[model samples]
Structure formats: structure tokens, C-alpha cells
Target: MSTQPAPASRPFSIMPPPPPPVPLPVRARSFALVGTFTASVFLSAFLLFLVQPMFGKMVLPLLGGSPAVWNTCMLFFQAALLGGYLYAHLSTQKLGVRAQVGLHVGLLAVTALLLPISVAGRSPEGSDAPIPWLLGTMLLTVGPPFFVLAGTGPLLQRWFAHSGHRNAADPYPLYAASNLGSMLSLFAYPALMEPRMRLAGQSAAWAMGFGALALLIAGAAAWVWRPVPPSAERADAVPADAPALSHSRTSVPWRERGIWTFLAFVPSAMLLALTTYITTDLSPVPLLWVLPLALYLLTFTLAFARRPPLPHEHMLWLQPPVLMVVVLLLLSGFVEEAVAAIPVHLAGLFVTGMVCHGELARRRPAVRHLTEFYLWISVGGVLGGIFNVLVAPVVFNNVYEYALSIGLACLARPWPQERRGWRGQAMMAVRTVAVTAALLYIGANSKDMNPGLLMASAAALMLLLTLALARTPLWLALCLGTVMMYSTVKAIREPGVLLAERSFYGRFKVVEFGIIERFHVLRHGSTLHGAQSLRNPRDPITYYLPHGPVGQIFAATAPRAGRRKVAVVGLGTGTTAAYARAGEEWTFYEIDPHVVRMATDRRYFTYLPDSPAKTRIELGDARLSLARASEPKYDMIVLDAFSSDAIPVHLLTREAMGTYLDRLAPGGVIAIHISNRYLDLEPVVAALVRERGLAARVSSGPDGKRKRYESIATWITVARTEEDLVIVAADRRWKPLTDRRVPPWTDDYSSLLSVFEW
Candidate 1:
């Protein structure tokens, strides 16, 4: 009631009720812009990722379980991705927003006709190369669909930029979300889809998801029909490198494009190299493949964020040290130990990938140049894949590509370009010479020194070198020389070594190691293929020892009445041939011809030459060779083919088993060498046995038993009838294989994920 109270009421509100809660139509448009585009990208990425592992599993049996199969698959995928990015770039530039929408939608509709993917054939017929055949098969089955899916990421990101949203200044964050979808699909495949469904069912589900993606894409296209305001279009026209908008209309510099290509190439090549190292040298389980790839994708997700959680400069600093650790691991011989090797490899992949991808994100062009950026990155990816898959195998005898890639990654660092003063130059020279001297000293004294001590010293020396030369361009050349010198010293020569051969299949070393009595050990990577006693040339000393299941197999079958025919799938040191008797017909089917030469050589193995039976060697992939060969019912067929520690998955499929059954004489038994440090192969054999109505028994070596030049062996014997299995099954050492319910491996589907030990 007082005048003072009236004066207090005058200062009511300068805020004006918070601007009317944003007009409904405006709010609706913004929501639609983000929601529709993000959904489209996420679903498209999921489908893309889901199909990779699914189709990889589908084709794995066709080519056997070589890690190279994944490499080839990656090559195809990268090519497809490049094609997609190219299409996106051209289409976006040539077409208006609505026309772009119409074109892609029409293409998607057309591609939908090829949905519900299925493998075309089991494998190529006679005279066909497996890698090319596999590539052709992939192209026929999933190529068009994958290409279409891959294009959606950049295309939809471009669409969102023109949708009149306030956050239109940036579209790269959507890329992070896209990668999240990719990462999720990778996790979902092994964790849910693989374990629960067969390949056919998974394909069906993927097709359904594709259809949903099509609908979401259609919804996103609706935004193109609406009018975008001038201000919003201007938002997307902002320069990628701010404070420098003068060249907005000009083409990006060639140097910047080259930087993008280089940044992308390092990570892409590193991914495949690390995957191969883990699968071929560590463990060939498909899950091991998932880890490196998942980390690789996750780096993209972390890097391209609007505000990256981890800084690019930090990765730049962290990468060199981690790279040094990786190089040291490669040289230390711990690569043979899975427990020690796997973590180091995966960690190196993640850090180096972070550095490369982080640089990519930092230098990303404007929204106006989004497709151009993506196109260059994809080209880099395809080139990297080609180098690893095609070029490296032909150029290098060993897996030198992995080491070479590590050095290239070091070169990718943003080294200081300014001229250093004399003091700084002198310091750099000193550091480089010191590193070179230390590595050369280690290499020279590697044989005489304690390997552990030398390895530790090398690691310490590398750490110091990394710290000193981190900002210098000379790190690349120095690191490469260190690797080459170290590898040459350690791997090329050994005391009492007979010979070493490296093929695309793997490295094979025939070394003589024994204190009192010399034994010739045939080693593939770290696993013993066979060992022959020089004291008794005919004596099979390793897994094929006289008391092992291989000896039992020949004891029962080699003595069969008539002209006995025996088939061995893997010709490891030809040790199984030692069990042969006079007039026995023995044929070894070996995937690696080098293995055949080495095993047949009287100087190295002599198991084949020393055997009393007549032996013939068939050189080619075991399954393909067997499939093409004339029908000859054998008394006993042995499945013992292995690459590194991994059994070729194709050799264990029902189709492969059928091939074996077709080749076997009535009542003949199949002896499978299932001994592995990482896989429970008995279960695989048991599942196949149960599904085929066959009887099987497992012979396991004594727990914790160690013998001279010998290893613990586990053999699974399978036959059409229980009586046929009697010879090995009746022995107390051999017991009935576990009959646990597990899926039978097929050409269409299999999951070693379930059977992996760790």
C-alpha cells in the first residue's frame, strides 16, 4: 500500500520470459536434423561392421584359417570403402541436396534386391588361386551392399550440414558416433550374434536391419525437401582452419591432402600388421582379430570428437615410446609367448593408431570439404591394405612388413622443421650415433650375452633414444636400422641350425639342438612340428614319438593285410611317414610346398626319405588338393595340418570331414592331432563325431610330463563305427571324447570364439 512497495514492483523482468521456449516448428526442425541423420549413420555403420566378421566367418573355411585370409578380406573392404567415398564425393558435388537424396535412395532400393546374403560356392574348383577366388567370392556375395553402406556415413554427414541446425558448423562429431556404432557391432557379433545364431540366421537378421536402415535413410531424406535458411548454409561455409577464411573458395593444398593420406596410411597399415602378428605368431583365434580392430576403430571415435577426450599432442608424445616397446618386443623373442606378446602388440596398435587418427582429426577440412577429406582417407586405407596384403608378401621373404610399418609410423610424427642451432644439431647427432652404436653392439654380442640382459639393455637404450630424438626426423631411419640389424643377427643365424625358409604360409626353421645327442627340430614359429634324433634317424622324437597317438595309429593301421594306403594332411617334418612299413603307399598333402621340400630333404628331416614305404608329396592347400584328387580309399587318414599353432579351420569343417570320409576305406579310422596350447580341439572333433554318427576317443599325454625332444600330445581318433575305433579306444591311455553339446563346424558357420582357451 506504500509508494516504496510500488517502486519495488517496477524492476519486474529484463529477461523477457526466456524467449518463448524456441518456436515449435523451429525446435521440431532442429530435432529432426540431428535425430534422423545420426540414426541413419549409426544403423548404416552397424550393418557395415556386422557384415565384416559375419562374412569373414563365412569365407574362412574356403581359404583355411590363415591370418592372410583376414588380410585379403580387409583389402576388399578397403577398396569398397574407397569406392563408396569416391561415389559420395562426386555425387555430393554434382547433385543438389534433393537429387543426392533421390540418387542414393534409388541405389539403396536397387541394392536391397541382393539382401539376405549367402555364400555362393564352397570354394574355387581346380586350378584356381585361393586368395583371388576368395576375393571374387566376397565381391559377388557382399560387394554392392557394402559399398552402398559405406557411402552413407559421409553422405548423411553432408546432409546434416545443410539441415539449418545451429550446430551445423561441425559435422565430424557425427563421424565419432558412426564409429561408435561400428565398435558396438563388432562387440555384438562375437558376444551375441555369433554364439546364438548360425550364419544364415545372422544374414537374415542383418537384412532386416538393412531394411530398417533404408527406412531411416528415407526419413533423413525428408529434411532435404524442407527449405534451408541462408544463415544455416553459411554456417557450413566456415573455414576448417579458422582465422584464415580468405581461401574458402580455393582448393585444398596438395600438401594438406598428402598429410591426410599419410596420417590415414599409418594406422590402416599398422592395423593389419598387428592383426597378422597376433593371429599368425600369437594365436590365430578370430577373437584376437577383434581386439586390434576394435581398438583401431575406437581411436577414430576418440579422435574425431568435437572436444576430444584425449589430446592429439599427447598421443604424439606417447606414440614413439610405445612404438619403441613394440620394436623391442619384436626383437626380444617374447613374440613366441602369447601371454607376453599379445598385450604389447594390442597396446602398440592403439597408441600409434591414436597418433595417426588424432592428426587426421586435427587437420580435418571444413564441412564444405567433408567428402574430399573422407575420400583421401579411404584412398590411403586402400593403399595401405594393398601394401600389406599384396605387396609385402611378394617383396619380403619374412614378415618384415610389420617392422617396416612400425618405422613408417615413426616417420609420421610432426617433427620440427625449423633449422636447429649448432648445439641442438650436435646433440641430435650424438643421440643418433649412440643409439646406432648401442643397437649394433647388442646385435654383435647377442650370441655371447645373456639374452634377457641384452633385451633389457636394448629396451633401456631405445627408451633413452626415443626421449632424445622424439622431436627429430632422424628417428625413422635410426629405428629402422636398429630393427633390421637386430632381426638379422638374431633370426638369420643360430648355433647348430641347419636351414631356415620363409613362405607366405609361415617361417620354418630346422635347427639341431641337443646337449648329449643332437636332435633335428622342425619348428614353425614357436611350435614344434617334429624333431628327429640324429642317433636314430628313423626315430620320431616330438609329437610323433613311439608312445604317442601317432605311433598307436600306425601300430594299428599300418600293419593292415593288403596294399595299405595312408594319407597325411600335414607333412610336418614327414614324421608320420616314419611309421610306414614296406610296400605301404603313403601320400602327404601339404599346403606349403617349402614344407614338402624341407621334410623330404635327407639333410633336414629325412622322415620321408628314411621311411621304408614309398611316399609321394602333393603340393597345394590340403583340402583343395584332397578335393581334386582321384578317389582312393585309404586304410588310415591323418589330419595334422597346422599353421603356426592354429589348425586350418577348413580342414575341420563338416565338408572337410565328408571329404575325408569319401577318401577313407570302409572301417578305416581318422587320426587327428588335436594337441594345442590354446584350443580345445577335442570338443571340436567330438562335436563333428556326434553330428556325423561316428565314434571318437581322445588320447591325452601325461599331465606336466616332459621328455627329451618331446611335447605333450592330444589325439582324437574318429571312425564310422565304435568297433572301428576299438584299437585306440580300448587302450587305457585313450578315453572317450567329451560329448558336450556344441555346434558342428560348417562351411557356412563356425565360432572358434567359443572354443578359445583365453
Candidate 2:
């Protein structure tokens, strides 16, 4: 097989392609392609992100109007993208440019059939395997669309290279431009797109632009043959003896396949983890999820720009340990509730990303090899996707991707220059001893060690670690780093102890807000899953609150032994189980194993009365559990699966309602917590009731002992019998919920802006 083919020989170019093995013009067209290719990449990248928030809004309701739905979808998308990149690499290495374009165009055509984005019907699903179902539906629904878009950056880089663009301006700055486009999409979705457009309008707009992109892609293919012809000597070409480009003179660093995997795996994992940390801590909106990422992309732009290099390029050095500290915080129950707690985590994530991207950019080959360079980045990206979305859930409890990513980051990182002297060795000994002693002292002390004081100790130890890393043996520092890191997580991660963190495809961590105050934070990617009081000793008033949806449902109906087969979808401190009355049967369908352990563990959910009554906990998706319940006819069904931003949307579709109604007594009430920070859920509830022929009403107001942080919440109760809903909301305050005032979120139709208060 020949390395190069003249276009005439290939039958496409107006002029004959260059002779066999025509060399890339490393300097000539490099500047020109930077602008045009950058613009093209920019446009495509812009559209790629724009669609995320747009489509997220469309499907908000079927997933319970929980912002977590979007985050989960993000995980799916990232995984699909990895698939796309893999396909691109395998096909393009041997396929000619014309064939690549032809193949990519075919994919675009196939995906175009999915345009004018719309979901079938909006209702939660009844499936024991909602996550897998959700993942499958999302991948199938958007796969073709995503695969074609995902190939843009790499393909354009190839085109720029084939144009024989030979300059420092070649592919790198275009990459900066490409990311700038990504930044715009991240920023624009929340600030501009959603606020201004409806789901249909947004979909239409994206579709229009996608049509344009297809044309531009075709145009780009047409332009690849300009300025050179097959078998012709180009007089403007520089001889091989000419000075090489400045950026091209640097030696290529040796790369192992594992190293490439590390680069990709570390940053992408950190990205998803940060997505979890922020969405869990901050508000759930496209804005929240996109902000830190924008910062990350901006770092790439600044790092590669002519701007003076700050201490940024080396920030990755401290990341592994930083990651360890964050993980330890998760383990130790140290997360604070304030928004301020989020920025530090975001900063750490940004630092990790910067180091990875900066290293990639720094080691990038000359423009001649731009195609190959991006191919590796894509490789790293794809591996990261698999590691985070596909592998992490099965490999560890909770999202340890952050810690794992940090570990890999260290492995991929360039080692520090070694110094062999007594001072160095002595300093090493002091640092090593200090970290070890701290670990032992803190670990063994148990109850005596105050977490705050311990945190301070950890910080001091990390600072010492960083300082030592700067001057000592890399291996010794890393050794201490790993141990200290593990110790920190052990101290903080009370997974099965005081804090009952559910481990799975989520982050459900409980951190001590104060000595006697524990705050349980739940997460789905970058969104908060849920939070509630970790009742001290026996404070059932705040924890049990006889008026909350579940509390009211069970307390009112349980004493009568009215509903023996009650099913609760989510397990939150098992507070709902506190309403258990004698002879009443209750089963909780919870997905996270950590949450199950926390619920069943003697240390947590004590009020739940371990093995009390007929209460049973089922481990699986709530929808599936509900669907399988044949005629035990639950007198009360609580849909708690949409706990927080970690929304599993496939659980809440029109089809899902049929499953629940089928298992309900004629008058049984289904109270859905329509509480969300992003999407206005009332409209979706209204639409569901409208289509399913059920009566629904909105219940509101904070009935609990209000605190400084009493969040205003709303609920929608749908019933087979209309009177039951009124009975549930009778003593409650309610405002008329209108179709226009709220977003009519369906499985196929949801938008945050439709209901967001300006």
C-alpha cells in the first residue's frame, strides 16, 4: 500500500494529486488552515456542546425533572464519544482522506434521520434495570448523531496536515480555537440558548446548523486539493535542507500505550468526578456543569498561547495527592455544605485537566503529524470514557475515579529531577517519617482524633509532601503520597460506618458538618443526589417529620394496615421506614449498594428498626421493581428514585406510569417529589396526567421546623382516584400549577429555561 495517492489517480481532485508519498507542506499552508480549520472545528465544537443542554431540557420530565437526568445522559454521551473516536482511529489509519470523508458523510446521513430531536412520550419507566435501559436508549437514540460530530476535531486536524500546513500555528492553536468553541457552547447553553429558546426551537436551530456543517465538511474535502496537484513539482516548496519549524525541532517523547491510556484516563475521570462534585454541591443546571469545564478549556488556551507560562504546566505534579486528599475527604465525612466547598474541588479538577492537556499539547508532533497527534488524544479520551462510565461502577464503590485518575496522572507525569545527597536524603527521611507517623497516629487514634484537627494535619502533611516532591526522590515521595492518600480516605470515608455511603454509579457521601451534625450528600455525576438530616441519637422530629410525603403516606395509611405492600424507590437514611406501623409491609427498591449498606448497617438508619415488621429492601432499579409487582396492589407507592440530580429518567415516562397504576389500588396515591433546581417539573406532571387520564395536583410550602436553609419545595400527586390527591394535599398549601408557567417535560420534551425564573 502506498503512503500517498494523487487525487487524479484517486479520481476526485480537479488537479492530479501529488506523486506517491508526497510530503506535507509543514510551513506553507499551516497558517491558512489554522484559521479555516479552527473556524470549522469551532463551529462543530460549539454545536456539540450546545446540544447537551438543549437535549437535556427536552428529556427533563420523564426522568423526574431531576437535573441528574442530564448528568447521567452526559455519562452516556461521553461513552458513545469514546466509541466514535475508536471507530475513527481504526478506519482512518488505513482509509484514504476521500474514503474517510465518504464514511463520515454516510454516518452523518444516517444520524440526520434523528433530527428535530424529540422523545417518544414523556413518562417514567417501570424497569428493574432503568440505568442500563436509560444508557441503551440514549446510545441508540443519539449514537449516529454523536459519532459523526465526535470525529470532527481529529478529521480536521488531518485535513490541515494533508494541506501540508507547516508552521507552529498548525494544529495546536487551531485546537485552542476548537476548545474555545467548546467554551462558548458551555457558556452559551445556560446563559443564551435555554433562556431564549424552547426545546423545539432549539432542536430546529441545531438541526439547521448541523445541515450547514455537513455542507462545510463537504466543502473542506473539496478544498484539500488546492495549491498542489498530483505528480507536479510545486515551485514554492522548500527543500528538505531548509531549517525546520521552531515547534518541530523538539524531540518526540517516547510513549507507551499505557502512558497514552493514563493521559486520557486521568483527565476524563477527573472531569466526570468534578462533574459529580460540583453538581452534588452546587446547583444543577447546564451552567453549573459547564463552568468548571470552561475553566479547564480556557486553561488549555492559555497554556498553549504565547502568554507567559505561569506555574500552571507543572500543576499536575501535585494532582495525585490532591486527588487523594479529596477522596479522603469523601471517606472521612468531611465535605462542607457551603458553595464555597465546591470551588476548591473544582480548582483541583481544573489543575488535573490542565496538566494532562498541557502535557499533550507540549509533546504534540509537528503539523505534519497533526492527524496522528489528535488521534492519541482521542485515544486517551475514549479510554477515559470507558474507565469512568463503563468500568468505574463495577470496579469500586462510589466514584473512586478521582483517586484512580490521580494515580494514573502520577504515572503519566514526568518525574522530578533526582538529587542524590545527604541533605536530600535527610529531607526525604523527615518527610517520609512525618507522613507515615501522621497516618498511623490519625488512623489508630479513632474517636479521639477530631476530624477538623485531622484535616489540618492532613493538609500540613500534603504541603510537606509537595515540598518534598520538589527536592527528593520521586519514588519515595510517591510512596508516601499513595499511603497518606489511602490513610486520608480511610479516616474520612465512613462508607459502612457512621456514614452509610452507597457505592455504585454514584457519589452518596456523608460528611460531618459539625461534631454532632452529619450532612449526607448524594450525587449523580456533577449533580447532588440528595441530602437529609443524619439524626443525632434520636431526633425523629426533623428526621421523621410526620408530614413529609412518605411520612404522611405511611403514617396515615399504616396504622389502619391499609397498605401492606408499600414500595419506596429511594433509600434516604431510611426515614420513610420510620412510619412503619404494626402489620404494615414495606419494601425499598434502592440502586446503590452503599446506600443499602448505610440503611442496613447498625450504625445508620437506626430509627428504621432493623428487621422491623414486614419491611424489605430490594436492590435494583425502582421502575423495574414496580413493574414486576403483580397485584400485591400497593396501597401506597412512593417514587423516590428521582432523588436528586442523579436522575434516572427512563424510570419516569408515560410507559412507566402504566406500570405503577397497574400495581396500585384504585385510590392509592403516587406522590412524586417535583423538587428540582434546574427543570420546572409541574408541567411535565401535568402532561403525564393529561395523557394517562390521571388527576394530579401540586402541593407546596415547607411544613417542617424551618431553618435558615429551608428550601422551598413542591410536589405533584397523581392518583387513580381524584379524591385521594385532594386528601393528601388537603392540609397542605398549594398554588395553581399552570401548563404555561411550568415546563411540560416529557421523555421527549423538557427545558429548564421554560420554567426557570429570570
Candidate 3:
């Protein structure tokens, strides 16, 4: 290559002469750009997270009672994010600066065409298997905006890198600023935007921001781009239209691209795992998904800060041991819900993040390839998000996202290899052998395990002092030590003591919270069954309490009136199955493996009285299960299959309703619980009914204990045929639900947000 004086010293080509120096110091400009970008990030991502919970809340009513769909949507989002990242990469690679700007603006214009981005239709034709299709619909509806929004981080960073005005030494700080903005968004949106702004207002505000973004993006592009100068471009500077280079430093800390991949994988997986764990154990408050994400976003903030971050001290000291213990414990299922274990979980993540991010900073590429390096990081993240969200659900029946997270966490942290001398090796070899023997002995006898002893023994002997006296390969010793420590068996294989239960298209496993922390059970994903209420496992009334709503509805439609057949859509722990009387025939439909086990395996459902109806558990999708049932059979149909935000919108479609009505006996009552924190589902119910010319009413607030429940769930009871339900009968407690009848939803008409906060 010919000598081109420094890139900073000469023009690239036929580009215009550089503008005279402006009054703003380059430092100030850098700060403003970073700060404004950060602020924009907060605004953009805040809406992103805010909308996730809010929209989920909006649609909860339409999908049968399944919270698992939330996870499904999250998976979809991650997949789309990857798609967006790949798109950004492709755009930057194929287009010149001017074209790239034009392409982005064009995408913005197309996305704007989808404005007032509210779901307005009802009656999805293919709702027979609606989860996947509705997912596609929502994504297409929201894609244009999100795609442009996603390009912000990568595109802006690229712009700053090639600006040719500031010290290129640290344009990376802008990335940190971006995450900071995003973190603030995660916190502010739920706490502020949603609870306050109506959907139209929210949509309007986002549209305004989009317009401003377009203007800023145009301005920024105009500030930096120019035709290449023939002399300098001829000399050896990169072409004005050169592809972003993917280069690495010689002494990059991890050295392997695989390690970077591992680094990227662990944090994202942890975020998802913690989100699931909390939703499972603590709460599925869709908005709570934000907490782990906030922590993750904030980690990027600290790791990529302008200087040594706040985590440096804690990272150097406590993060290692905490990470080690948490990894071992998590791998062993000692601290299952990273959500319930927030204090320790956050601490471990914080420490591990410090080391991990510090390494990322340490190994950062030369300023020339900074943008490309981040591109790879985002690529890895998108991959992780895909694995956790897109692939995991179809693969495992139970929540194993947490297990993968533990493995990745360990992978992110390297071993302390300094002590791997000679004797240290011998000690490790002996320890490995001893631990193997102990494991074998325990396995042979098949008895109690002393997890504490095994862990302590490994820690005591593997400490650096012992290693100093002994020559060993520290990496190998630690590897064996990790195996030995991780090998310790758990005291209890099953954590939750079964309580009041129901199963939906989600997992409703509740654990004994314990004194000082009273135990409360929560559901996380889609399971076509029910839950175990800790409300005296011996008490069936909590679920099918003869004094409850089902009990009351059955009473009002008195046996004297005629024979009343019943169809319970979800048979979780089969709590509702107990509500069946001698003359009354009931069919229970359940769809999860774990739920089937909990209900009839003799391990969990000991409270149910043995009878012909007790054995009537049907395993499959509730809609399918109900569709297969005899038509015109049941007087009371309970729609509790989807009870959380991760819901399948198909169950509430007009076609599903037609199916329910076709299957219902005259004067039937359908009880649907619409309790959710993030979405306003009543509107969806209203839309569905309005489409069908049916009447409805709602019952809000907790049935009994609110704190024990965490979030309040609503019940929107509907009728297939008209009969006076002057009062709702709930467990000898006759609480009056809404009396103002609402409309029935039809396939040609259902919009969840349509009935929200109007």
C-alpha cells in the first residue's frame, strides 16, 4: 500500500475540505453524542420492554389461560432481534454510507405505515393451533419498528467510529452509554409509561420519537459522509465504502472466538433463566421479566464504562467465590429460582460480569474495528437469545433454561491456573480419585449424601496454600475439584410441597415459601393442567371448593333444573375434579407431562377421592381436548387453560368459542380467570363477546389473600345461552362480579387492546 499520511491528516478522496473546527470541544461532542444516544437508547428500549409487558397484558384474555405463551413471545423477540442484527450487517456491508442512510430511512417509512401498532383483528382462522400463527402475526405487526430500532446501536457506533473528528481511541463508551439508556428504559417504562399512558397515546408518543430519530439519523449521516478524495484514497486509507472489518487484538484475553461466544451466551442465558425462575417461584409478573434484563443491561453499562467500573473491587474480591458457589449450587439445584435468590443471584452476576466485561474491555479490538467486534458480540447474544427462547421450549418439558445458564456461567470464568505445579497435580489426582470413590460408594448403597462434606473437602484441599505446597496443573485440579464439588447430591429431589393446584397451558408448580417467607406457588409456562395450592393441601375448596364460584354456579343451575354435565378444560393437580358430584358427570383435560404426574402419580394428588370421574384425565391441548368431547354435553365449562401472560391467543378466537358453544348444553356458564399484571385482558374478552352477541361480567381483586398471590387475577364469566346469574357464588362468599353485560367475541373480531383502559 502507498503511504497515506495518517488517516486523520488527509482527505479520503474527492471529499470536500474538512469544516473549520467548531466551538464544542471534541470531548464535549463525544459526551453529547454518547449521552444523547444513551438517552435515545433509554427511550427506545424502554418502550421496547414497556410494550412487551403491556401488550402481553393486553392479549392475555384472548388466549386460553396459558402463561407459557409469554416465553414463546420472548423467544420470538430474540429470533427477530437476530434477524435485525443480520439485516443491519447486510445493509452496512452492501451499501455505501449514503445508501445505508437511505435504506434505514426507507425502512422507517415502511414501519411508519404500520403505525397505531395495535392488534385490531379477531377470529384467526387457523387457531386450531394458534400459538405459532398468532406469534407470526404479532411479529409482522411490530417488526418494522423494532427492526429500525435495533439498528440504532450498531449503526450509531459505526457512525461515531468513522466520524474523523473525535479521538477514536474510545468510541466504545458510546456503547456503554447506549446500555445505560436501555437500562433506564427497562425501569421507567413499566413504573411510568404503561400505568399512565393509554395505548393511543403510547403509540402516538412512539411515532413522534420515530420521526425525531429519522431526523437525527439523517443529520448525523450528513455530518460525517463525503465522497472519497482521490489522493488519500489512492494512498492507503480504507475506502469510503469499505466493509466493516472483523479484527481482533493479538493478546485478546480470551484468545478464542468460542470464548467470546461463551461470554455472550452466559449472561443472556442467565437473564432468561432468572426470568423463568422468578416467574415460576416468585412471580410471572410479565413486567418482572424486566428486572433480570435491567441487571444485564446495567452490566454492559459497568463493563464498558469510560473507566474502571464500580464492579472492579467487588469483582476482584468476592465475585469469584460467589460465582463458584452459585454455579455449584445452581448446577446442583440448591438455589433454583435465580429470581427468588435475587440477592445472591444479582451478586454473583455482578461479580462474574465484572471479570467477564473487564476481560471484554481488556481484549477490545483496536479502535479501527470496534464496530465489527460489537457486531460479533451482538451476533453471539442473538444466538443465545434464540437458543433460550426459540429452541428450548420445544426441546424440554420442564424449565431447564436455568441448568444451561449454570454451565455457561462456569464456562465464562477461566480457572486459576497458577498453582498447577507438580505436587498440586498429584493432590488433584488423589482428590479426583477419592471423590469418585465416595460417589461410587454413595451410588452403590443408594443412600443419603453429605453434600457439605464433599464441597468442603474439595475446597479445603484445593485452596492455593495447599496448591503452593503441592505441584499441580491448577486448571486440571480446579476442573476435577469442580467435578467433585458439583457432584455432591441434593437432599431433596422435589422442592415444592403440593398445595391448591390447577394446570393451564403453563407450569403451575408452587413451592412451600417457608416461615418468615410464607410459601406461595406460581406458574411460569404452558401446561394443560392446574396448580397445587398450599392452602392446606388437604383442602380441595381452594381449587374446587364447593363454596367457590364453580360450586355456586352449579348450585344456581340446581340439579332440580335438570342433569348438569361439566367439562373442566385444565386438570392441573385435578383440584376442580373434586367438585364433581354423584349425578354430575365431568371430563378433565390436561396437557403437560409434569402436571399429569402431579395429579395422578400418587406422589402428589392424594387429596382427590377415588372414583370413575377421578380417572377421567385427558392429556392434550385443552382446545383440542374440548373439541374432541361430545357436543351439547356440559352445563358449566371452565376456561382456565391459560392463566398467565405467556398465553396462546388462539384459544379465545371466535372459532374456539363456536367450538365451546357447539359443545355446551343450553344455559351454560364459562368461568375464565383474567388476572394478569402486564396486559389488560378484559378488553380482549369484551372484543370476543361483542363479536359473538354474548353477555359477560368481570370479578377483579384477589379472592382471599392478595400478598400470598403476588398479582391479582380476574375472572370473566360468560354464558353460551342466557340464564339469570344475578349473583356469583364463591365458596359461601357471594361476591357480586360485573353485572353490565359485555359482548361475545367472534373470529372476525377480537382486539385485546381495543377493550383496554378505555
Overall lDDT per candidate, in order of appearance: 0.76, 0.58, 0.54
* lDDT by residue for model 1 (1-758), tens: 11110111111112122111111112243666688888889899999989998888887766655556876787788889889999999998898778998999999999999988888555666445678788888887799899999999999988877776655656788999899899899889888898789888999999999999999999988876678665555423542322122232346778778888988998888888777667766665546677888899999999988788987667766776677667656665555568776887787888888888876775666577889989999888887888877877677555677887787787776656367899977877887777767765665565578878977886787678667777775654575557656775666665877887677777667888888888888777666788888888888767887777777766766448347888998888888877788888888988777887888788887878888888888877777667767777888889888866867777888898998998889989888988887778777788888888998888876446667877778888888998887777778888888866778888766777678777
Better of 1 and 2 by TM-score: 1
* Prediction 1 global C-alpha lDDT: 0.76
lDDT of 2 by residue, 133-201 (tens): 566666666556777787777777566545545432234566676778888888777667655665677
Candidate 3 at 6: error in angstroms?
A: 22
Per-prediction TM-score, please?
Answer: 0.89, 0.70, 0.68
Error of 3 at 637 (Å): 3.7
After aligning candidate 1 to the native by TM-score, how far in Å is the CA of 728 from where it should be?
2.5
Better of 2 and 3 by TM-score: 2
Candidate 1: clashing pairs of residues: none
Q: What alpha-carbon RMSD in Å does predicted model 3 have with respect to the real structure?
A: 9.8
lDDT of 3 by residue, 565-585 (tens): 777776655666555555567
